[model samples]
Target: MQHQAFLDLRTTLDLLKANGELSEVSGEVNWDVELGAVTREVLRRRGPALLFSNITGYRGPQARCSRLATGLFASFRRISLMLGFDQQPSNRALIEYVLKKNATLVPPVLVEDGPVHENVLTGDAVDLFAFPAPRWHHLDGGRYIGTMGCVVTRDPQTRQVNVGLYRSMIVDRNRMGTLIVSSQGWGGHWGKYREMKRPMPVAFVFGWDPVMEFVAGSPIPATICEYDVMGGYRGAPVPLVKCRTVELEVPAAAELVVEGTISDDPATYAPEGPFGEYTGHVSEIATPRPVVKVSAITHRDRPIFRGTLEGSLPGASGENSYMSSIQRAAIACNVLRNAGIPGILDVFVHPVNNGTTVIVQIKKHYEGQPKQIAAALWGSNASSHRYKFVVVVDDDIDPGDYEAVDWAINYRVDPGSDDIVVFRSTFGSALDPSTLLEHRQLSELGAGLWNRMLIDATRTWRFPRRPQWGGERFPPLVTPRPQDLELVRKRWREYGFAGWKAEF
Candidate 1:
């Protein structure tokens, strides 16, 4: 069966249910730590998507939208299904699919009306707590309403629109705060607005189509609008509706659209987080962040709130890490190929490491090719500086197979001769737990320096075979010949192993 673009969250959920990948929970749950705890357990067990029908302690307008959804993209099979693949795809296949689709840019189409405008609240009616916002983790400073949502921003000078996925905390009625990393797209826009001495007009969209969220979080080029990439993935223009208050356009079928202005006044800043981040740590301390003064709230009636469980163990398998890894891997591969780095076969960013470690497979054509690949990757635009470890292996080894990678590292590498290029004083991720308090303090002051290691595990060359290089035969690999392996595979069933299969 062919897969089509899902217009909204409900349609995506319906597809998951039809495929037997979703489960509904009728029991009333709390928006506090209880909901997050349950979701974490489910994600750990690789369980189905969850739909919480009843949420306790949420009354009045909030009670109308008591339903919440979580764990939508926990499995690779589910991700493949959402991406319109015929069957479950490997990480490399998924990355290649995105890379191919991303080559063509498709702009979004603007419309006058959408389900998000079903009810519009302006002025005093705009309450940030009207929905069931959850405190996803025990240590989080407050209830976050935008864990799975997209924040919209635009450059004042260039007029380039950017949609980014940043965690947001509800401060009060008509007020929210979001954490913008120093290197993110939205942060650049915010900096531009700050230089222009104007408040940044922004909108937070919740409960959009699954593909929309993926595009928002992916590390696309800064010049390309995420909406265009969304259209490319969907094979059609994404329908957008103008926000009631902000000048931005939001997903037409979004469940909620919060229009606001990020205040430039330092006095309006508030403590945003001690929340657990995707790096598997709660190392980020509570700090003052820019406040967003909400001007309007618009939503569909009885909307479903989508919440993502981020940080540490649960987040490793969560939507953000999974999608980011795929996009990063694709970007890393493209960067290497575009730079004319020869023999780069594949790249895999470990989901659990959150891009801190990357595995690269290459066909070694020369003696120093592995070191060259490692150096090229470190200097690429794929955020290689943040990577603590970059492993280079032969094309015969699968980068995603940890066992094979480990074997290559153990046997093919001699630490003395093989390169372990280490660079000190480089920018590191703020969420890295290994970062010392002193280092973090320095990083906060514009000196975010750390160390990076690159390991070359390619097979060593003992002697040169070419006459130009003083003709001496090189030792052959110890593995069985290709013909012998083919004979073994062909006679596997005939060898009295009826239910067994051989993997070559």
Candidate 2:
């Protein structure tokens, strides 16, 4: 069982293709809307990861970067592959793996040079449109180049670095419009810079090991740098190179790197979004957002531009959803552990909502355990946009089974009793469509307000135990005895059910 990281995007793509998990398009596709539509359609069909080699206006010999790769981590099978698992691992297995890795810290090592510096463009040579920046949605404000890119920043006082996934739209040839909420990882760095009245140096890293994206997008502790966690995933020191124009370091093998600075000055603000977010809906309309003024652009020789469609649909999703399913659940469980809350057996996040709702299976330890779970999850910085709905079930229930969770909710949860809990006006995702526009205004509120809900699906312990209840607070479920089930299993073949297998 050797688990290692795919050091570069090329190797990762090759492995995906060899595994029959990636599909390449040789035909030319328009970058305007066609490319995004194709990617979305593939996700809808649960098809292979995509590689568009022939995009319109990007096929000429002089093209800087022609190929585009998206949806590489859109499925559990692909994600398992990224984690070095030959066969698709179970959800529980992946969650446990992520939990351990998230806690491990292997600091990155500095490298004087690498592939990212093969070509460096500064001042007039830098062009944001040189690579294909897809207009993922027709209603989108503009082409977003940093949808899946990692944004690197550092705290002014402690100088503790943070790598986060923040959306960026091409504002001009050397400027990008971005929505930086004060509640996010990078937002905290921006605030420290703001207090100092100094522009924040920033770098955007694209296309390296997918582990960079995996760790950067997660809600790891503020004290631990994501590069360290990424190193833990790789089982080696992550080699990083200093950015030309920023005080941050990026993966040495990253396909492309953009270095720049962001200031709070109104002059640096530009009209930014209405982007199709991971919430499956467009957020606030185009508004003045802090913009990154590019001072330098660096890349590998004939770099492969990496980008992904951001929105998640009913039957379709992308890398963010798949990655979050494991990361969010593990992070939540870690939060519970830190709070000293016991009885947590399993945590599950359905890809559809990307952890907006979570299900936790636990052994009943106390009457108010469900409330404790909700409080601990909400209190954590990781819950800024997650764990909005927490459902706690008994050990007998499986969190992954929606029907089982639903049944538990219906039978065990009494709406008017303490079984249901709601935490109002808590910090949450500004992009949640359900959140009122006024609540999402970043200018006023630092974060969105969510009325969080907790459905205690476990059986109530307040009831007195009777002779028929077998000394238990709650009545026993109407299930066949273990010996009775064994008898049925043995006689199932003799009872004219030879073709069917009894799994229970």
Candidate 3:
């Protein structure tokens, strides 16, 4: 991996542009309507994101700016680059990188000032509306500004840093209604402070390297601080600067920084959502979330507005953001390895409704053994407790290859013998539709256990058999000739493949 220090959002935009991953537009775009519509249309076509240069209703001369560059992490090639791996490295390779670097914790460095501190707007002068906030969906309650930003908070007792990528909806210029699922680590920290009747400090950072954005979404264990993990992911200490108005440190090169205090009181319930969640559905959750009375808003000159959609479509809540799913699978695989599972070749958790559903696969070692392995997988620290469904398969099956896993599921396993539903022990996410019940039903159920179904999709047998793994016993490997691939690259136009030409 190379060290590419981005000085500002413009530099990050330029890098995306130079890599042919950005779309440029010169028309007049509106933050309230046009920006959201265009992004939806582009994501529908699975097209590159556009940067809208001229937004409507500007105080100064109609400024040249662009929006929506590299939405949904766009490409696997880019994901691998972001993770510091080869173009097409396997999940195993990714896990190796994580384990190798996790021990050498690279602490973040503090700086006096960076791009984020360039133009500080303190107290009443700070207006979040000055920037273009996108109203992504028609049914969305409000325009969201921090879809791609990292919310930085720390434990009130331990002071362990927690970073999460939660949405920030613009309520007014000075106030944004943040969605906090209090069960989550970051939210739990705020809940603890709220119990003690103390204000929780928070700093949200927009527009840093995409790697930081990814880390913001990662499930870094409670013991390890995300800032340290961000440092590991970057292969260098992330440069952070202390906020002038809040007790928080933000990325020095962040395009925009928001500093505020979270009011920790359930009595202050705000009518939060009808906004689209990661699942393609619109749901309402009433929680006493942090009402950030913005102490300050800081940014560099001409800071680019960065965003992503989150409602059940590609680039929003869709499969377009497969990198995180892939990363989650990698994390699960690591957990299994730590548990001494053998013949674990690969794993993949695919997004259904884009990212709401998870399908996990593990290589089968022995006949009828896949059942035991499948059940044990539910105990794995990374995914077992949380995933909706987990399927176990043989090495003959490619977990990441959706087609192969489907074939195994259809032809091999009989549900009567292979499918087993374990009760009372599992936990699930709030986004799960089946878990939430009516108030009357809740009285009977008493907070239901999220029942996850694990289908032992690997081949079942009548008798014990040897594991079909190792050297030549593994499935025949296939790869295109380097010369042939190069030839196809040069002659792709003649072969009627336009996308390839654009890709190359």
Candidate 4:
């Protein structure tokens, strides 16, 4: 079967509709908390994508012209469809597939015109509140307009553009505040601008091609441009068009683009968040962050606003963190493979675990190999500092299977004997609530310091019961014999078992 490119938000929605994966809510909805409530319910149910045609509150052109969409990439089936896959594969399979396909780089193509320029608001006419930006959670400080969006910025020295998925909260008609962790790429860019005492030009894209959303949220290497990885996913260059006010460029078919400049002055900082974050917890405290002064608001006529429920609810659905975990796993796997780590079979990063806690499956060839693998993972860029737990298992154990992993940890691991390496006061995720401000230690990069643990769950020795039973002679797993299991699997359907298919 031939596949189609999910080039733009409209195209992706159309595909979803055609596949009966989209749900339309035509009744009038409020932007304050009603929309978020509904979106939360839908996501909790693992329901279809929502397209709200009518929005209440605003009485201008935006009321009639703007719409809202949520749950765009909420399910495995939706993700598979977006990636142009023939069948919905297991999470591990999908990650491996994406890693392999993304190997081929495809640069973006510049375009003169696109649908995003159908209507443009520049200079004094720019208004950040033109659309129905949802107050996603009741406890959120304000309506966030850039939850499912990408913040585009360029480095001052390198001039290399970095597209990051930072939540932007609308503060006023022409200003918005966005969180920038000191360790993130955008933070690095802003840090340079702060050092230079110059405002950093930024473009916030609310609705663009679905591929852009995925790439923006991905942990792409700082050296490789996100657009290039986006192109690789699309199997072609992502079409781009120059922004109206900013020096940056945006996806040509973007639904809404907010061009602005992030003030570098510390005095310009605004109280940013008390918002319910992806960690599924509302930070009791808010912090002062740089605010973006909108210079332009460009979009297609009758544009749709895309939003995501970022807090704990989506995490419970198991859909929210899937992509991030997959991408992080791929990065970890690549790091290990490139370092000449042998017998590496698979890698799975637990999604709900704050994108930390990586599980590695490897073929055990020698003693102390699992410890080496764990150490390599801990030292690598993909896992170092970021990942909190590293668990190494044998190839037979599926990394994606938590139950299997648990069994391996319980049986193969000895807390005292097996290596459980711990590195103290290392850089860690700021979102980790465990790192209290009072007890927090800061790295030079401003990352919070925390301890990381590595568990070597892989079999370390063959039969230690006897010296004669040595070398590649480990006791076999207690289960049905391979040939016996195969025979039973092959004829299971003939035995008249219900829902017993060969593949399952």
How do all models score by TM-score?
0.90, 0.96, 0.81, 0.89
Model 3, range 348-410, lDDT digits (tens) per residue?
Answer: 666433323344454556555654555555564344225556677777777767788888778
Can you tell me which runs of candidate 2 are displaced by over 4 Å?
Answer: 482-504
| Residue-by-residue lDDT tens digits, candidate 2, 1-504 | 466754699899998999999999999999998998898899999999999999999997899999999999899999888889888878888998999988888999999999999999998999999989899988889999998899999998998999999999999999999989888889999998988999999999999999999999998888999999999988889999988878889999999999999999987799999898999898779999899999999999999999999888989988899999889999999999889999899999999889999999998888889899999999999998899999999999999999999998888988999888888998988999998887888878877888999999999987787887888877888899999999988877677655676653
Higher-TM-score candidate of 1 and 2? 2
lDDT of 4 by residue, 1-504 (tens): 245564688888888898988998988888888888888788777789899877786545636255788887777788788788667887768777778755656888899998999988877777777888888788999988888879889999998888888888888889998777666778789889989988999998977778787778866767777888888876788888999888999998899998999986768888777777777777535677779989988898888888887765433543446566767787778777877878888888776664577888988778777767766766654552356888999888999899999988998877886557787776666666777854432223365566888888887664455444433445566689889999988887678868665553
Select the stronger candidate by TM-score from 2 and 3: 2
What is the C-alpha lDDT profile of model 1 across 1-504, one tens digit per residue?
Answer: 264675588988887898998998888788888888888888778799898887786644636477888888777777777887768877877878878766668899998899999989999888877788888889988998888888899988899999988888998998887776656788788878888889999998888788878778766778999899888888788999998878899988999888999977889998888787777677567778888899998889888888898864633467666766777778777767877888888888866765778888898888787666656766653462245788888888999999999988887777776556786766655556677756754226433456778888777665447665346343456788899999988886678757676653
Tell me the deviation in Å of residue 102 in model 2.
1.1
* Candidate 2 Cα RMSD (Å): 1.9
Candidate 4 Cα errors over 4 Å, as ranges: 1-3, 58-65, 312-315, 380-386, 439-445, 462-477, 480-504
Report lDDT (Cα) of residue 389, candidate 3.
Answer: 69
In order, what lDDT does every prediction score? Answer: 0.79, 0.91, 0.64, 0.77
List pairs with backbone clashes in candidate 1: 280-312
- Candidate 1, RMSD to the unseen true structure: 3.6
User: Which candidate number has the best lDDT?
Assistant: 2
Give the clash count for each candidate: 1, 0, 7, 0
